[model samples]
Target: MQITLIAIGKTDRAELEELISIYAKRLQHYIKFEFRIIPDIKNSKNLSEAQQKEKEGELILAQLQPTDTLILLDEKGKQYTSMDFADFLQKKMNSGIKNLVLVIGGPYGFSEAVYAECSGKISLSKMTFSHQMVRLFLVEQIYRGFTILRNEPYHHQ
Candidate 1:
């Protein structure tokens, strides 16, 4: 199955982008991986938090295919260890899905509509992280998960 990570906005820090790119390249060896960015809304400063989320949600929804399984990276979602995440991915691959879309929402998070479209939600950690950092963290974890699946030396128990 192809894995896609769709996130809102860009990573301004060069170091973070470089790190994400490194993990992304490593991930390509295991599966078809795509990192897609939905540009931030224009004039966001004037919009209310709810309105911003709504606009961002629209852009996020537009990127999905009908058959794609959407998973949101939400703080309040189910938390799993690295090994468990590998198992989760294995199950999805076994299920014969074409694409697995994992989303990282904007600052105010996702709208109600976006939440409705998702198949499930996953939490990387209980503590909050910057959106840019989340991108890097998610990419590295995905790479680590693949390594764990293959019995590679990238991860330790």
Candidate 2:
């Protein structure tokens, strides 16, 4: 199955971008993975939090196809261990899913519409993290999960 990560805003930090790229490249060896950035909304300063999320949600939803399984990266979502996450991925692939779309929402988080459209949610950790940092962390974890599944030496228990 193809795995796509859709996140709002660009990664402005060069170091973080480089790290995300490294993991993304490594992930290509195991599964079809793509990182698509949804540009930040213009004149966001004037919009209310709800309004911003609504606008961003529109763009996020637009990127999806009918058959894609949408999953949101939400703080209040289910948390999984590294091995468990690998198993989750394995199950999705086994089910013959065409694409698994994981989304990271904007600053104020997702809109009600986006929440309703998602099939599930996942949390990397209980601790808060910058949206840009989450991109790197998620990619690295995905790469690690694949390596663990293949019994590679990249991931240590």
Alpha carbon lDDT at 59, candidate 2: 98
After superposition, which runs of candidate 2 have C-alpha atoms over 4 Å from their true positions? none
Residue 98's C-alpha lDDT in candidate 1? 98
Clashes of 1: 0
Model 1, residue 10: distance off in Å is 0.7
How does each model score on lDDT?
0.96, 0.95
Model 1 has an lDDT value of 0.96
Candidate 2, run of 10 with poorest lDDT: 140-149
lDDT of 2 by residue, 1-157 (tens): 9999999999999999999999999899999999999999999999999999999999999999999999999999999999999888888989998999999999999999999999999999999999999999999988988988899998788
Instruction: List TM-score per model, in order.
Output: 0.98, 0.98
Residue lDDT tens for model 1, 53-138 = 99999999999999999999999999989999999999999999999999999999999999999999999999999999999999
